[model samples]
Target chain A: MAENPTPTPARPRDAAIGTGLGRVLLLVYGIFALSASARALVQISSHFSEAPLAYLLSGFAGLVYIAATVGLAIGGERGRILALVSCSIELLGVLVVGTLSIADAVAFPDDTVWSHYGSGYGYVPLVLPFIGLWWLWRNRPRP
Target chain B: MNGPLSLATIVVALVLGVWYVIRCALNKAPSNTDLWSMLGLGLLVVVLVVVAIVGLFGPDRPADWTTFVGYLITTIAFAPVGVYLARLEPTRWGLLILAVAALTLPVLVLRLQQIAEVTSG
Candidate 1:
């Protein structure tokens, strides 16, 4: 068989969603996933009754972060949808929970990742979803 | 966890983190020297984690020993993970990844120190 002389040109724009800058985002998301889930595990296992709502929220946030990380890692049409959903939920979660935690402090005796708009985490939790959404938008599949 | 060692690690990591960020901004991929420096930082982190682990055997132990151990594991693994990801990337973003990892180390180290200070023994 004769070899083709012309090779396919690389298309940076159409590269896998998890490459380049996406990989950097993946690392940050991975860290958050690990930390949030671990924190939830520790809190729920050690003293679930003390702050049931907060602990559950922590677990929920952890799941969201994990989903986002997986979505970024997968990086395709399906991955985009997954990341979009998770990031939206994260943004909403942070805002609603932040407000509730501040407005009704008694209900949230403990801090979740979103409490006080993630002030406890240097507000990274609050900022992360925005960045995730922006990245997703940037990597949207073109027609 | 020795205070001086933690301080040194944090200082070095922060300095390297800044440098990596600058390199990334300049659109530079991670050079061999850059990767090697990260490994060197990783070695420093390994030593820090080892000391912390050995501290666990001493009379005084962190009140939240489980969390401390978890952070120690994460801290030790962080640098190698950064290096691996950066190698796979081979782009400016790779340096940014290293920067993120480098910056996060100080936070982990500080948390470790805070946990260690609250010894129950």
Candidate 2:
């Protein structure tokens, strides 16, 4: 409305989330959730037999994304833990799968979300976990 | 998906992306004006999506029209979703939300173009 600006308030170490950085985190997570699921749907429905491993990885990626989204949206101590666990698993999954997809191309005839460290998606899958972890650390609750 | 409409939508979205990125870097809270501009962009996207809908009925329908239609829903709803989140956040992150949406629009538009190219009528 007015040019008047609201001084950015310090967020609760825990109470409310998705206000500042959490909002951006949510947006990114939302994007991943949508894209992973959409891509899996396309691959599995069209030609699952062509590359079952890759397509299944896509679906697994989608599930993790959904878990992360719910965890972030819930926003609490346990919520943060859920988000942390999911994001950490995501990081490891992407790295391991990403390396496998690249190092052993024959094993992956098709691509997953983490294929080649998510080069297809601008390396966002690779980068997202670090951001997620950072967000959680920043919002660590004061018990 | 194949007309001046989609092209314009991409160009305008990129421009808005640059604007939002700059705002985020500067740590500015999203202004009402920013929201209005986003709404304007949303209107443009609506126009492009509607045109694609009309194209769907025409003689050259894309194969797997279902996915294309699904993307159309995502594309049309994207900006308004960003605006709603941005409004709730009211900070630099809000600007970042706009930036993300603007960046995403081009991807969706490009996907629409690809799907439209594989026609079955």
Candidate 3:
């Protein structure tokens, strides 16, 4: 197979953060960003009182996803910091929320993106953060 | 929202998704044929969405019509977005992106079907 040479100029090492596999990651992150935010919007608008805590968490998750997506899209030192922070928060949120949702069902009357390790969304939420972090780590500037 | 149409779309997407995954594993970029097949699947989704919109005006309409319409829009745009992103990255990962999009379509369709099933009118 002939090598598919990339025509884009190779400069600003940070550009690598949004190419190749990173682009695939961007697509997944974008999907999550849209779905999470939209879900939160619908939930909050239609029935905020039903599960305020869960709904708020849903909104927070949506913002985190949006931040991560933007960070990946931007792809530079600033973007890396943004992505790193959000991914860390996401990882913590999923683990904490997942465990709490299982241990104390009463508190979580309704589900958020992180609830039950995102079983409702096929656990993609649980796994996405790890992937995001790995991608960030892989793209980190070398000494 | 026709059962047969949804089933066909799901099957096609799953098949294409599998093929894309295999190609990615083999380190192959998305070929024109792959992209065209995805566009064809996108066309099928559009038909399905149009049928769903027509169904909304029929006797039985979804109780949460707004959410149903939202899913319809998302479902219809999914394939083209996948194709566009895949075009940007011409590598094995592009195939993976296509695979993800194809696989996600079935889930979206299933959700649409679920919403359609719960009728208020």
Candidate 4:
């Protein structure tokens, strides 16, 4: 039995954030970015007076999602830091906003992406930040 | 948007989305057939969108035309975009990407229906 011998070109295992499962994360983040931003734009532009706090929160959430998406896609030291900060903030934002939105309905008459633990988005928003953080931690630079 | 065509699109997308996810769970990267099925779903969505666009000119249009059109454009473009990204990553995760895209389509279509229901009364 002769074993076939051929030089298999070694592909560089660049531990970028936007590779493998990270690519799937990027896609999900991209979808949230578009959706959150578009929803914020519509809410703020059409009726900012209706729910100023909710609309502003929506806008902020959108920016955070956008930052995370960009950071993951870029995947450098700076990008990792950016993604870390944004994802942390995102986790905090969803937790605080989700609780507040439910505890006090008057303040959040309109729903943001983080409202009620992202129930409007099938709770994906609530879970995304955690995933983002895990991905970052998994791909952390070695000493 | 509340027609049989849109319903069919939603059903097809859900079925394909589940199939893709199952395949991914079984550790299968998306094959050509899988990708092509997605493209076929994209074409169906296009037909649904075109029908909605034609209906837009008729009376009793939705009050929020801009948002309606925005969702329409998103729905039409989503599947192909998924196919493109999945092609770039030929792994189980790529199949998950298509799965996510397919699942999101039903939500988008439902949202379109909701927006379209708001006629100027």
Best-performing candidate as measured by TM-score: 3
Put down candidate 2 lDDT per residue, A1-143, tens digits, no spaces.
Answer: 24438776643445325367776778889899999999899889988999998899899999999888878777676778788889999999989998998899999998888999999788999999998888778777655
* Worst window of 10 by summed lDDT in candidate 2 chain A: A10-19
Tens digits of per-residue lDDT for model 1 on B3-88?
Answer: 99999999999999999999999999899999999999999999999999999999999999888998999999999999998887
Task: Determine which window of 10 residues in candidate 3 chain B has minimal summed lDDT.
Answer: B85-94
> Which pairs of residues clash in candidate 1, taking residues 3 or more apart in a chain or in different chains?
none
DockQ for candidate 1, C-alpha atoms: 0.59
Better of 2 and 4 by DockQ: 2
| TM-scores for candidates 1 onward, in order | 0.91, 0.87, 0.92, 0.91
Candidate 1 total steric clashes: 0
Off by over 4 Å in 4: A1-18
> Residue A41: error of model 1 in Å?
1.1
Candidate ranking (DockQ, best to worst): 1, 3, 2, 4
lDDT per residue (tens digit) for residues A30-109 in model 1 = 88999999999999998899999999999999999999988767767777788889999999999999999999999999
Error of 3 at A38 (Å): 0.4
Give a tens-digit lDDT track for model 4, residues A18-100: 36687788889999999999999998999899999999999999999999998877767778888899999999999999999
* Residue A112 shift from truth in candidate 2, angstroms: 2.2
lDDT of 2 by residue, B33-105 (tens): 8888899999999999988999999999999787889889999999999999888777898899999998899
Residue pairs in clash, model 2: none
Relative to the unseen true structure, what is the C-alpha lDDT of residue A114 in candidate 4, on a scale of 0 to 100?
96
